[model samples]
Target: MSVKKISRHSPPNCGARAASASVLALMALLGAAAQAADTYNSDRPGGADHRLLSRYQGSLLYMYGEEALGKADMLFDDKGKPVMRPVEGRISNRMYWGPKKKSPLEVYRNYRHALETAGFKTIYACETKQCEAGAVQDAVQDLPRKVVWKDSDIFVENTFNSANQPGFHYYSGRRTGPDGDTYVSVALAGGYEDEPVFGRVRQFVQIVEPATAELGKVSVDAKAIGGALKRDGRIALYGVKFDTGQAVLRPESTAQLAEMAGALKAAPALKVYIVGHTDNQGELQGNSTLSQKRADAVVAALSSKYGIAPARLLGRGVANLAPLASNDSEAGRAQNRRVELVVR
Candidate 1:
């Protein structure tokens, strides 16, 4: 009798409401977990001390021992040429975005300070109007065209534009690491007072570790060269080195030159077409000119220094026309940027 009196009525669909609330709570938990998975921690590798606005992306261009060109400056000359003083090393490019209410200047300063604390000395730094010159804009636009990987250029451009919002800011620096010298370039923009939507700072960091190997002694002797030539009709040479953005050969190239000279001397009837190749890094015309100059330099060295007849070797710059490997990677680029002796 007491139980029947107590079991009167349900409280206005309370059970349904409780079930709905439980479902909502479960969904909320799932949403939070998904968001956490998408967003990286502030201390993510190669990221600054800021909340990651979104997922982080990176491209390891050149491996530990490969060469990479690091941008030392972002400004341009009065003649309109973007002053890209390139630093060579093992290159890695990384990007991250931070959603914060901080101003552009504040974000720039925070990144700069972090870099300094991490032992990076500023190579170049600029802010606002100083960084918004026509040359800078052109450089930003032309980067995709110049780089071998289009995604990297796109990432850089989008990050730079977003972070630098109303104006622009750029920072580049270097630090000595255990492996080698680590170069860092940071481009910060966003949080412009003029734009309401621009509140996120984007950072593009390029780390270039110095190459570990240099041309040592002449490993490829005359016999080896002759055999390779006899078998392949063409032999690609790697030890022939050059300074970054220059036609001049490094002193380390002496061993390779000597070996090449010895090979020609051993074979009296051997004449080769000295073909120069390069990785796709800059303008096609400029690379063609550079390859030509590099070939000329090699020929000149062989003839004048090693007493090989100039007529026996014809210098030709094919630029990146022929690549032995894919140009998508640093190792491949290193392999492509070589001198080849083709039987004429």
Candidate 2:
């Protein structure tokens, strides 16, 4: 996090204010272009950035959600300003950073550049002044996330979360397809200064068509789990069902969870690691953390919901570091994202 700077040098006598403004603008642009210590291509929470876009360089993917058929809030910088336009279809919610100089224009532009490169044609966009006056900020200081677990991604989340919340602005995208013209909307919340600013915040809400999951065709039983773990020392089980961006176990997973508890009960001396996996299709931002949380959730369910001994189940995540199949296809990616009972 950066603190507000106070220059001690005396002001220049000629065109001093103009020089200051010019310098500030230059700094804002430079900050937008500044790369973090490592390259971050965090396009996650689902299958490789469904909109075909990656996050802005140096930005971490804080939170994302998707639904096959849903609705998104559409914002326009037009006469109506920040007023909402709700559109229905396959909905996805993605909130990203506004590591700002307080002047959101610089960071906002760079973020948009990343989106535009993915072939979306911008139809509407705006900065603070362009929005309607008296529009309210989001309900809270920080946008709520689905799960708030401490992961390596938390450090970067802390960095962006510290910035002051600013006014709402927007940009929309339209792409022509054989089906029709699909729209994409991005709303930016930006401020206007540099001396005391450190973050830029924006959100994108989209609706994409829903699709079916071919997973969960078979449920693993206690016999199968024990046999596999005994023979191979581990078993990749897709019986556990987790939604695209969800960390909690679904009610439908009760059958498999019961079977797991059964296997544990049958073998008193056995202990296993409930390892979680997510396919690395687009980005690696919070995949490991997300995977860890999912694994932990499974462990919690087995212990509290069922009667598995807590000490016997250790949970961990391996991100996309290990993949059982290629990420080039949805089928292969599904196979890659699974939970395994690895004997300890």
Candidate 3:
């Protein structure tokens, strides 16, 4: 299920028009309030401020969320492409709604200055050329699974993904420190051919603080995987790591995914169920949805990246129903959060 493509309104001034055209046609009730300082209301009920940076005064915060471990594309490579870097620490995404007259370039430049003034060195700056969608989507799409998102979040995500495509500005910078580095990427656009009420300019901001990904926490050894499957019906794998609220496996999980592929190759006739399990933190239904997506992600990764046969692997999600350990404590919860391969 792909997100609805709606931000088709490309500003006339923005050089490259987005492939399509459509501003977010939100529900009438919600659309009226997307702006923070509208005629009747000027209240800030949503998250007012982000930790590393402050919000632009005039814009309304459409959405705000953070991830413990997430992926973000940062510095540009020699080919002038954004590098998809895994953020180890806290990843904060803030989406804002800007006034129509204001072009996206203005807000983007202000954000660039803020980062630079705060000691962040500009690493990737492509002001005129359009920014890549992956760098923007990575931040916009990562939301917590536990909470029921507001209508505004969906609207913001849809609008920015379309608006940031072409005729926009992208800037990413990093700051070095003794402990680690901080990364910030800003994507914004201001060209609306259609509805003016939906917001002429929108900005998507992602900030990554330094942290550890618990590297080498687990080894993806085919021999061990095979041995465990031979002895037991299934084996629990923690090596397939995910952010607190994300289903996509972390880059660190590549080794494990590769080994899983190897294990399947060793036994040509082997057919197994790839089961996704989660801690009992959020609602059961929500956890089940996340688990299912994760199971599907693993299956897709195996099929696409490792050349594992799709027929050989079946994906399922049992949510918190099958717990490896008690969910009473943090350690137990961590133990319970795992992906398992059970022999069929």
The RMSD of every model to the true structure, in order and in angstroms, is: 14.8, 18.2, 19.6
Model 2 residue 315 lDDT score: 99
Question: What are the per-residue Cα lDDT tens digits for candidate 2 across 269-338?
Answer: 9999999999975557689888999999999999998888899999999889889988665656888989
Give Cα-based local distance difference scores for all models.
0.65, 0.64, 0.72
Q: After superposition, which runs of candidate 3 have C-alpha atoms over 4 Å from their true positions? A: 1-46, 130-154, 160-167, 191-199, 213-344
TM-score of each model, in listed order: 0.40, 0.39, 0.44
Task: Write down the worst ten-residue block by lDDT for model 3.
Answer: 140-149
lDDT of 1 at 149: 32
Candidate 1: tens digits of C-alpha lDDT, residues 8-95: 5666668899999999999999999776544433333333322311122321121011124433333324354336666665555445
TM-score of candidate 2 to 2 decimals? 0.39
Ranking by lDDT: 3, 1, 2
Q: What is the lDDT of candidate 1?
A: 0.65
> What residue pairs are clashing in model 2?
90-207, 90-208, 98-199, 98-200, 98-201, 99-200, 100-199, 100-200
What tens digits encode model 3's per-residue C-alpha lDDT throughout 37-100?
3621332356656777886667766666667765565555446665645444667777676755
Best by lDDT: 3
The number of the candidate with the highest TM-score is 3
Q: Show the colliding residue pairs in model 3.
A: 8-21, 8-22, 11-191
